[model samples]
Target chain A: MTALAERPYGGSRGGPQGGSQGGSQGGRRSRGALALMLPALVPVLVFSVGPLLYGILLAFTDARSGRNTETSFVGLENFAELLSDGDFWESFRIGLVWGLSVTVLQFLASLGLALLLNQDLRLRGVARVLAVVPWAMPPVVIGLMWRLVYHPDAGLLNGLFGTRVDWLHDFSLALPAVIVVGVWTGMPQTTVVLLAGLQNVPKELYEAVSVDGAGAWRRFWNVTLPQLRPVIVAITSLDFVWNINQFSLVYVLTQGGPGGRTRLPMLFAYEEAFRYGFFGYAATLGVAITIVVLAVLGLYLWRQAREAD
Target chain B: MTRALKHLALLGYVVFLAFPLLWLLSTALKTPQEMAALDPTWIPRRPTLANFADAFGEQDLLGAALRSLVVAVATALITVTLALPAAYALARHRSAAGRIAIGWVLVSQVFPVVLVIIPLFMVLRRLELVNTLAGLTVVHVTFVMPFALWMLRGYVRAVPRELEEAAAVDGAGRLRALAAVVAPLLAPGVVATLLFGFISSWNEFLFALVILKDPEVETLPLTLVRFVGPEGVARLGPLAAASLLATVPSLVFFAIIQRRLRSGLMAGAVKG
Candidate 1:
């Protein structure tokens, strides 16, 4: 009985020791991975997540500029005010129009351009390089350049037609002017993505369509469009997000102006916070805009996921 | 008939793309009289470099350009440095968490910089970093890092792990194998990421406008804005000249990187 109990106890102890060692090794590996990840994660958490959370918190408080002491818990007063403000609603309308027009125009133009460039044509390389220039330009510079071109006197547009018309100063034309610049600046990446998609399409398929006596239009509609559906969806979704968030072009060109003609949601938020000193209201706008963007993005992502299966 | 129509359409598009740039160059070279002339001419009569000189003289354009360069280059370098290791981990480490991390980086790009500007401004103000080059660089790196990580992650994943493993078996550590066996192969991707980050940072305006309020710390775009204040009459010739000068660095940078932006590099590298 003594020998049997001693042997069993010794064996159990040995087994536990081995298991503990293995557990320690696993723990060390996980710890090592966490250590490697912490440096990258810390800044993102502190700067990215921290500020976003603070902005959300500030939206609920009566935060103001200058004194910084006026911040008190105002509850949903900011949201109610933003909801009632005609200027905020106008800005939202402008943003919606701006986003829709820019996305549609840019996507179509870029898709066409990409398709054109994908062909085995002379000067394809040169055209591709030229296409990227507008996108590479600073939005402020683009704004200023277009503003110059749209100037009533001594501007390129008026000069070309020999008819002076105020582009920015006119309420009707200001939003359209901003949209044109948006399309120009956003075309390059969409073009590149579509071009990549086009290249992925097999040559044999095109040849097969040709053998079936399909013309260029028929081939493009049947073969190319289906092949490029994924890319089209991706680029359109990205363009929407970008257009919705755009601030620099509108800021520099119109400053939400010509009697508040081109005020985007972001521009309105900026003016409220910085120009008008309504931090809480501005934060509400920010939150609203964020929700809108996420909804749009979420829809696209869900569709993509569904299609992926 | 179809071919003719296609050619006409292509020509029209090309003209649309090229006209604004051509007009800018023309305005820059035109004499003040020519620029202000009622009759618009495609080419400047009595073209002169006086506008260019005036643009340089009227503002610290050169100094601003230099500052922009420093900020862009520093941001690119710093972003690439921080992103490289993280990208490697994301690409090579096959796990659920790694996938989530990669997705987060992509999602972060969608956040408008304007939303975070208030907090960033507050932080920078408290740190006494506003209006400083370092402040701008930090803001730039924060903005550029997500995209750099996304792009570089794709590139790094393209590199074959077997090559690194083979090197590891020959008595090299993981870091050493990464440095010697994998990095050289990733040169194109590295260049692409660096160029993309640099250009994006260089062109950034909103943060620069709010943060760099001091005239001494102003960038090219801000300086150009100063040329067209509400009170002052717009100097069409000088402003056009200045705008042209501002575009030069980006144009040059894009030209340099255009050749390296082929599609199959990532797909080919990963598959091989």
Candidate 2:
């Protein structure tokens, strides 16, 4: 679908429209298109690109403890500070673990669920809708809900097991607890994508695989997995970006608590900028996150290109 | 034998997904004494809607829900309004710039809301739009526009350009053709886009949390968060009830649009 849209058909069709209506009508159409695009584009540019550029600028300066206007250039000092800051490095490692674990677990869970739902099973529609509940819930709500579920005293876990475990309070358990919520929140969208991919795989191939005495696993590997590669790449790349940026769940659940053990770089950045008033340092972290996201995207696109070839 | 195993695995997966939700519903109905029992059980000992009553009375959840609905509906309307024409142009106009515009839409989704939140905070504060539904709506529209455009663009492109061109040749203006002819065929797409945009805005938390500081303007999610007091102590029964209430609109929306979602998926073949 996307490929066809990108294909260039020549300028000959332009002649009919061009001759019938000279510059004025064409100008009007272009104007109309611009008008339609401006409302959407302005907010995106102002909020997204504007901040990104500002953040990048802040990373190179010694902007601390004031509005952005008070900043002066300190040329890579923030990045240099980040390089030596063990806390920053530690948070980076935590972010890496959070991103990779959540992304991998989410992909697997969703893929498994998608494969299951793709089968000729009863009540598959119900399963699909039910699965999307987590995704539909706000992240803050999911975080709070899970926090309740994971609470030490009266949580569902404690109630079910009759043993108290501090899921979010324990340093070791905190990250995983947050990651579980992340996985739950992300699984639905991934499942939807994978289900779409699975549907695209022609049924005849599966039938053929079965007739050839290929088992379920064999059929999946040979037919389904190959067919789902593009979607897998897309979903995984998206998961990486989403997981890297995840803040609400962690914030609401732990606030990077138990001595910053659960602190992902995003939480670290927030605490630095807002709480600690280290705007330049936070901007540096934001730049680092952006770099990692772009790198992951670059890698995914390259893999997608190779897969296409 | 393998088929049995596969079915079993699926059943297990279903249980995993459904159990937490069931627990939430049960907890919402349980009496406080039953809920606080040392040996807790899944089924409520004395099932009642008292918890729900308490939740509403205690939390002002009904008001928050109305605010959420207003924001979600406004965001959906504004996002679709802005995205439709651009999506239409990208669909019908075969140009290099149009292709780039489509790709750019995908790229826009990659930037994290957290990165934008700080600057947006500053921006909104500057405009004196903070803590207002209007402010949150602007943020939601910006957040949802990319996905809406991407989703609708594919569906719009699927509607044969010849149909709109035929209408144009019949002396219909582009806007008239789009409204009278092209739109009816693209109803499924429009619904799907609206559902996606609506849900995205409806579920969004970060922007709402940062922008809406006024308690009166709180969205459902933000209000739900108020259930948690300092040090992570939460009022479970009320929280569960509010959670269930918060989910009602989305579930209703999903039920109404599920058929359109399916057809849109099949037609566009875009996973979105």
- lDDT of each residue in B1-272, candidate 2, tens digit only: 37677778777777777877777787788777876777667788778888788888888788888888899999999888878877776665545566556666666656655556666666777798989999999888878776677667667766776788799889998789989898898887788778777877787787887789878899988888788866566668888888887777677777676555544433333432
Q: What local lDDT score does residue A99 receive in model 1, on the 0 to 100 scale?
A: 89
Docking class of 2: acceptable
Q: Looking at model 2 chain A, report the run of 10 residues with the lowest lDDT sum.
A: A3-12
DockQ of each candidate's interface versus the true one? 0.28, 0.36
Q: Which of the CAPRI classes, incorrect, acceptable, medium or high, describes model 1?
A: acceptable
Q: After superposing candidate 2, which stretches have Cα over 4 Å from the reference?
A: A1-48, A62-69, A122-125, A207-212, A300-309, B258-272
Question: Candidate 1 lDDT, tens digit per residue, A216-270?
Answer: 9999998999888766777787789889988988888877888988988888887
lDDT of 2 by residue, A1-309 (tens): 331342232232454544665678677767766666565455446545676666667777766655546767888878888889999889888988999899999999998889879778766767877787776666776776677678676568877777778888887888888888788888877787778778778899989989999987798899988888877876787788878888888888898888998898888888887777676777778888888789877976887788779
Model 1 residue A265 CA deviation (Å) reads 1.5
Position B87, candidate 2: lDDT: 77
Per-residue error (Å), model 1, residue A205: 2.2
Worst 10 residues of 1 chain A by lDDT: A1-10
